[model samples]
Target chain A: MNISEIRVLIGDDSILARKQMKDILEEVGVKNIEEAANGQEVVEKFRSFKPDIVFLDIVMPVKDGTVAISDICAEFPDAEIIVISSVGTQSYLKQAILNGAKDFVQKPISSSKIEEILLSRFERS
Target chain B: MYTQLFGNYLLSKNIITPDQLVDAIRKRNDVFVQPNTIAMHFKLISATDAEYVTKIATDKDSDFISTAINLGYFTREAYDEVKDNTLPEYLFLGQSLINDGILSSSKLEEYIVEYQSNNEMIDLELYSDQKDNLDQLLLNLFIIANEELPLYIGKYINLLFTNLIQFIGEDFTPLNFLPCEEYPVSLCSYQRINGVHPLTMYLDLDEKVALEFASRYVGESFTEIDEYVKASLEDFLNLHNGIYNVNLSNESSIEMKLDPPVFIEDTSITPGEKEQLYMLPIVYPFGTINFLFEIEKQETTSLF
Candidate 1:
């Protein structure tokens, strides 16, 4: 799939975090993007929106990103959910990967990392 | 970091008025380093000698390094090193005050001496990313609060300063501790740092300071304090704690986690059950904000 045609979902509790990721995704020419303020919302959006790429934060209100990742990946099986969170501790990273997250990037997120992920995802290998 | 600290010191010492300090802070960003200022920091030239060199260099329209070297105020070897050296931002505060005629170079020299002697932080310029210097700085802050500095807490405070400079602007200083009980909530956000180092941190400041802080953190200006502005404060605290958690885990295998920030509208706040509240006030170019760290007290196991 082309980079611009890829769908993106951002799940973070902070409005700042969502806006920041949205700005970076737009900068990278990703046109279809969806946002969820909490883990529950993100999981629901994932089921309905079926975004190709998901950015999840660990700490959220009702449900957490780890749980959301597990939920989405369990049903979809091929879900591409990346853990974008501040608390990227050893256990957190292990759990995120084991539970179904594709990659983990610690916050505050940088454009270079986003670009690298996108390039790696869309490039013909 | 020491730049804002020195500015705070001048205000505390009554050497410069609050208005003068704020004015200097607003203009301190305009200050670029000069060789004379670097020489003064190196102690190769006294502040008065620096002043004289500056005057002569100005009148003759000559370069300061060559003028000072010719005047025997600085040796050739000193000139070679000092020419390449840059002044610490700490001196920018004093330089700004001097330019505004609010202070004299000689008086600034005296305060620098007294402040260094008191805090044992001797020279701000040499505070070069050294762990020892950071520990000393944290110890001095604890000394100001009339308490002992624990090593564990020191690590967190050190990371706090590091993250503040990394995420926020460099124009800020951490003042002495503010008694938490005396605080009346204007705008406050709290987040729990859960795990081995159990603590809940709070960021409290007025709405105006919050707006400016949010602007700096997000790199965008907002005309008012709204949800995004509040989220900026929460995100900042969360971000700092998050990085600290990563450091702890990577260094010692002691993993920690952060809770989402809570914005409080209460008139006042107290520590959570079994937690003791400690507050530190940090001054930005915009205004003063407070950090309240509510540490969980250790429980003693009684053998009866």
Candidate 2:
């Protein structure tokens, strides 16, 4: 899979966060990108868009990223969900990994980290 | 921070008028003592050498110290010695106040003694160099009676000052924290920290100040409060809160999550029934910005 062909989904309650990540992904040659504002939206968008990669935030209004990860992985076991959160506690990290998240990135998100993740995932595919 | 605290003390004691304080701060910002002036004050360089270096610096578009060093007028050690004696802004403000004749030298000395005694502090010169001493002074100034809140609030404020120095300009003075029921905000961005202990942190600024602050953070001259300005302000808050949360997680094993920053315009934010709101006013060259921290004992029930 080429970088531009990868479908990316960003689930963050912050409009600025989503826009920032989208801009970074676009700069990394990601052509198809989708955004969700909450955990419920993340699961819904994952089912509809079936993105190759998902960037999820832990804190949201309707649903959180941790539970959404579990939901998405339960239906689509091959789903590649990356948990992105400002909180980097051991408990959250442990829970996110146990829920089948592929990786974790803390905020404020850096472009290099996104690119590294994207390059690694693309290589695996 | 001590400057603003001392200024407020002077205002409260009727020793200096508000106009005088403002004038002193404005003058303090404009007062830039050149290296030659400092060297002359310390008698490190002769007047003729200083004048020669000044001429060359102007002609070469260089600094006085570098030009003097290049011309062998003064050693680097002498330049460092002169630089070491440079005064901090608070002292500069005091000198400016005295120069303006708003307060006599003797009266200023008395006020300094009283301010130090009331705050149980040492000389201002040492206070700026010592972080622990400055933190102690901040605790004394802001945390009057609160016990637990002071620990978090003090850490938050210390980190805040560090961030302000890192991102924004370092030439700022923090005023004493004022307890207020509500703040009339022109532009405000805030985030809530939820988990074991919950707190709401916000930066409130006047429209013009917000534009200036965003411009400084983004390294762009923003003339208006547009989406870019708003996003920059929100990103700043998020970055600060995110760093604070990471520290808490790494050091204390505490799990606290941050809500997405919300931007509000032309409104007043009121504290909850059980919450206490503190407005920390920080004065910059452009304007003053108030950082509002609201903390409550009760656990947050809602997710948003």
Best by lDDT: 1
Error of 1 at B54 (Å): 9.2
CAPRI tier for the interface of model 2: medium
lDDT of 2: 0.77
Interface RMSD of each candidate, angstroms, one decimal: 0.8, 2.4
TM per prediction: 0.82, 0.72
Candidate 1 at A118: error in angstroms? 1.4
Query: TM-score of model 2 relative to the true fold?
Result: 0.72
Model 2 clashing residue pairs (backbone): none
DockQ of each: 0.77, 0.52
lDDT of 1 by residue, A29-118 (tens): 899999999999999998889898898999898988888888888898899989998888998899889999999999989999998998
Residue pairs with clashing backbones, model 1: B3-B90
Tens-digit lDDT string for candidate 2 (A36-112): 98899999999999999999988676877788999999999999999887766777788899999989998768899
Q: Supply candidate 2's per-residue lDDT for B236.
A: 85
